[model samples]
Target: MAQQVRGVVARRKGEPVSIETVVVPDPGPGEAVVRVQACGVCHTDLHYREGGINDDFPFLLGHEAAGIVEEVGEGVEDVAPGDFVILNWRAVCGRCRACLRGRPWYCFDTHNARQKMTLTDGTELTPALGIGAFAEKTLVAAGQCTKVNPAVAPQVAGLLGCGVMAGLGAALNTADVRRGDSVAVIGVGGVGGAAVMGARLAAAATVVAVDVDDRKLAQAEKLGATHTVNSRTTDAVRAIRDLTGGFGADVVIEAVGRPETYEQAFYARDLAGTVVLVGVPTPEMELKLPLLDVFGRGGALKSSWYGDCLPSRDFPVLIDLHLQGRLDLGAFVSETIGLGDVEEAFATMRRGDVLRSVVLF
Candidate 1:
C-alpha cells in the first residue's frame, strides 16, 4: 500500500519550506522505501528552494540521507528490508555509454524510482536530486540505497551520501592528490573543509585553506589544513602562492564555484598542477580565462560531479573509515534538528554559522 508520511516541501521558489503530508507510493519495480533517520540540509536543497536549480516547483527537499530499508520492490536482490543504507542520487545505469565503456562513475543516465511521490491533492512532488529524504519514509530506486556498516551513527553516515563524499572524491578521486603533494582548497565551507580532510587522508603535505570566514577556516584547520588564508582582506592568489613555496600549490581545489574564485584557483596552482571544481555555479555565471594560460598550464582542469562517486564502492569504505576513527565524520554534524527547522537551518547555512544542521526524522 502507498504510505503517507511527513516531509519537508518547497511549494515555490524563495519561500520557506514546510512540513507536509506527502504520499509515497509503495515499492514499484526496482524501487525501495527507506525509513529515513537522518538527512543533512545541503546547499543544493537551498538552491532548489531559491529557484537556482530550475523552475521545479514544489520540490521535496533533502538528499544527503541515511536510513533503514523497510521494503523492496520486485527484482530488488541487492538489498533487503532491515538493511541500514545511505541513500544516493546516482544509481548508475549499466547500459549508459559511460558504464559500457567501463567508467560507471561517469554514467550519464543515473536514475531514481520511476514512480513519483505526490501531495494529498495529487500534485506531483519532484524529489530533490531524485532522493528526497527529509521525511519519515521516502521512496527511491533500489539502486539508490548503498548498504554500509550499521554500527556508524545515522547522523554521521548520511553525510557520505553527498557533500562529504563529493569533497573527498574531488581531492582523492578527481584531483588525484599525491602523497606529500601541496594542496590548496578555496572556500572553507562544508565542501571545502571536506576537501581538506580528503587531502589530509590522501597524505598531502601542505593543505592551505582559503575562505572569507575565520570560523570556517578554524574548522578547516581541525580537519587537517596546514595553513589558512582569509581571502576577504588578502589577495587569495598571492597568499596561496606565498604559502606554497612561492610557486603555487601542486593542486588547487576550487570549492567556491564563482567566476572570481575560479580564476583565483586557476592562478593559484603550480605549473602542470590540477584544479578540481566541486562548487556549483548558476546558469548566468560565465567563466572567462586567458586562452594562453590554459595552454601554458599544461595540466588537467576538471569538474567533479558528486565527486565522481560510485556509491556502492565508496560508501562502505568511507563508513568503515569513519567507524575506525580515521575520518572525523562526526565533526561535520554541527547540530541536529527536527524536520520543522529546515528553513531556519537554511538561514544558518547561508550565514556560514554551521557546518551542517542535519534534520533528524
Candidate 2:
C-alpha cells in the first residue's frame, strides 16, 4: 500500500516551502523505502525553493539524511529492512564507463527511484538531488542507501550524506591532503569547516581557514584549524603565504563557489600546489584567468563532485571514526529542529549563525 506522509515541498518558484501530504509508493525493482530519521538543512535546499536548481516545480526539498531501510524491492540484496543507512544521491551503475574504469565516484550514470512520489492531487514532485528525504518516508534506488554504524546519532551521520562529505572528500580525495602538508580552506561554513577537519584527520601540519565572518572562523578553529583569516579585512593570499613560511599552502580548497574565492585559492597555493574547488556555483558564474598563470601554476585544478566520494566505502569508515571519537561529527550539528522549523532554519543558515540546523523526524 502507498503511504501518505507529511513532507516539505516547494510548490512554485520563489515561494516558501510548506508541509504537504506526499504520496510515496512502495519500492519497485531495485528501489527501497526509507524512514527518514533526520535531514540537514543545506543551502542547496534553499536553492531548490528559489527555483535555482531547475524548473521542476513542487520539489521535495531535503537530501542530506540518515534513515532506516523499511523495505526493499526485488533483486535488492545490498540493504534489507531495518538497516541503518545514510542516503546518498549518487547510486552508481556498474556498467557506466566511469564505473567500469573503476572510478565509480565519477560515475556518469546514477540511479534513483523509477516511480514518482506525488501529491494528493497526483502532481509529481522532483526529489532534490534524487534523494528527497525531508519527510517521514522516501523512496530511492537501493544503491542510494549506504549502511553505516548505527551507534552514531542519525543527525550527525546524516551530514555525510551531503555537504560534510563533499568537504572531507575535497581534502582527502580531490586534493589528496597528506601528513605534513599545509592546507588552507576558503569559506569555513559547514563544507569548508569539514575540509579543515579532513586536513586535520590527514595530519596536515597546518590547517588555515579563511572566511568573511569571524564567528565561522572561530568555528573552524574548533574543528582543527591552526590559523584563521578573516578575508573581510585581511589580504587572504598574503596571510596564507606568510603563515606557510612565504611559500603559500600546499593545497588550497575553495568552498565559496564564487570567482573571487576561486582566484584566491589559486593565488594562495604554492607553485605546483593543488587547488580544489568544492563550492557550488551558479550557471551564470564564469571563471577567467591568465593562460600563462594557468601554465605556470603547474598543478591540478579540480572540482569535487559530491566530494569525489564512493559512498559505500566512505560512509561506513567515517561513521566508525565518529564512533571512536576520531572525527568530530558532532561539531557540525549546531542545533536540532522539528520539521516545521525548516523555513526558519533557512533564514538562520543565510545569516551564517550556525553550522547546521538539522530537522529531526
TM-score per candidate: 0.99, 0.99
**Residue ranges of candidate 1 with Cα displaced over 4 Å:** none
Q: Which candidate tops lDDT?
A: 2
- Backbone clash total for model 2 is 0
Error of 1 at 73 (Å): 0.6
* Clash pairs (backbone) in predicted model 1: none
User: What are the per-residue Cα lDDT tens digits for candidate 1 across 239-329?
Assistant: 9899888999999999988999999999999999999999988878999998999999888899999998888888899889888999999
Point out where model 2 deviates above 4 Å: none
lDDT, candidate 2, 1-361, per-residue tens? 8999999999999888899999999899999999999999999999999988889898998999999999999999999999999999999999988999999999998989999999999999999999889999999999999998898999999999999999999999999999999999999999999999999999999999999999999999999999999999999999999999999999999999999999999999999999999999999999999999999889889999889999999999999999999999999999999999999999999999899999999
* True-vs-predicted CA distance for residue 97, candidate 1, Å: 1.4
By how many angstroms RMSD does model 2 differ from the true structure? 0.6
